[model samples]
Target: MKPRLLLTLATVLGFSAGTVQADTIGDPVRGEQLFKRDCAACHQLGEGAVNRVGPQLNGVFDRRAGSLASFSYSKGMSRMGADGLTWTLETLDAYLANPRSLVSGTRMSYRGMKEQQDRSALMAYLRTWSDKPQNIPEASPTARPTVPELDPKILAIQGDPAYGEYLSSECTTCHQRDGSDQGIPAITRWPQDDFVAAMHAYKQKLRPHPVMQMMASRLTDEEIASLAAYFAALD
Candidate 1:
């Protein structure tokens, strides 16, 4: 065969292989379990839930972020939608792993799922719900607001020490006094960022413990920061 023809054939074959690999990388049954445990609180399965804490996730597989009606999305989400971002399995997987990092300033208070398997399962489950075709709205012709650049300074510890003590009282129920609790993980001496990330994980349903999720969900980001700083300051 001519060298030029061989190179063309190799490129076509490589592209075909990549397409096949992309199609074969998810498990729906595992995804379903992950979804029920993690996402069911805010999102309904088969259709039409019209905006709860998070927007309805049905048919979210290929949908743009802020296109749903009646849902009050955060400025971050709306900006992403206007930027023409689509949700493919890969994108969904990354987003579910960590919403804030993937798209800074997203209002979905949930932290990213920590485990790779859990993220993959969640993606699979989401794909099943998205089997139907969806018609996404066009982005408005006018410019949308920009997502604020993340300020690392906002993550600094600057709260009333007494309030930190008060917040720690609730956490000790599971986290324990010395940070040693049977059947529950310890949090003493963990880094400030790690502690905040964990609380975010619980709030986001990325780490599935019902009581923890409920408790974490009720805390504002400011409260989460306070609690995290308090715990990090502990010996």
Candidate 2:
């Protein structure tokens, strides 16, 4: 679906957070399927869920955005939480339809799910993991990761750290030289393959951040390899 269509659909659904109903909606079974297909790579749910690329979805209902102490959220998401953005049914619906429309600089890699039914199903599945009055043991069937693997040839590229240092002047503006996460997450000390994969995701527009996409789009393959090498070596 076109980006504009997704944004428009988000608006048309029209469930304001202030007046949202907490009642369960949609089929959980179908929601499970949708979650496995689209969400398993980044988010985990049910009991004992831990942080992955994204925060665990457990207890997300009515939770403030970026509230997890363990997960490193984007500046945008943290700011939203500080401004009282809670994840109610309406807000989730809007976010699912168009993520960037809700949190512009969010690092969530997946493009938003555009179909309303699909979004409803996914949210329903996620809601099963939320805290409830009844003491129910959490259980979620394991699902395989859905992130696409990179080509072996791409992974084999050798990089020059000196060239990477030359390129890194642009990167260090947002990412700290001292490896502390100020507002942006720390990029220093990442493994080369993982760094390459993430940059490729942005370059291919598989990830949703516009600024990242723009930056990655202009870089040649070797430059990305060099940047990965340089960052990986940082103490």
By TM-score, who's the top model here?
2
Report how far residue 154 has shifted in candidate 1, in Å. 53
Residue pairs clashing in model 1 are 31-121, 97-112, 110-204
TM-score of 2: 0.47
- The C-alpha local distance difference test score for the whole of candidate 2 amounts to 0.81
lDDT string for model 2 (64-171, tens) is 999999999999999999999998778888989889899889898668898888887887788778866355333221221223234445446698999999999988
Q: What stretches of model 1 exceed 4 Å from their correct place?
A: 1-23, 132-235
- lDDT of the candidates, in the order given: 0.70, 0.81
In angstroms, give how far residue 81 of model 1 lies from its true place: 1.0
Q: For residues 1-235, write the lDDT of model 1, one tens digit per residue.
A: 2545654786887655344312333567887887788777876766555557777777776688788877888788888889987787667768888888777788777877899778766776666566533343331111112222224544454644467679888888767868776988888877877878888899889999888897887766657778767777776
Model 2 ranges with Cα > 4 A deviation? 1-24, 133-235
What is the number of backbone collisions in each predicted candidate, taken in the order shown? 3, 0
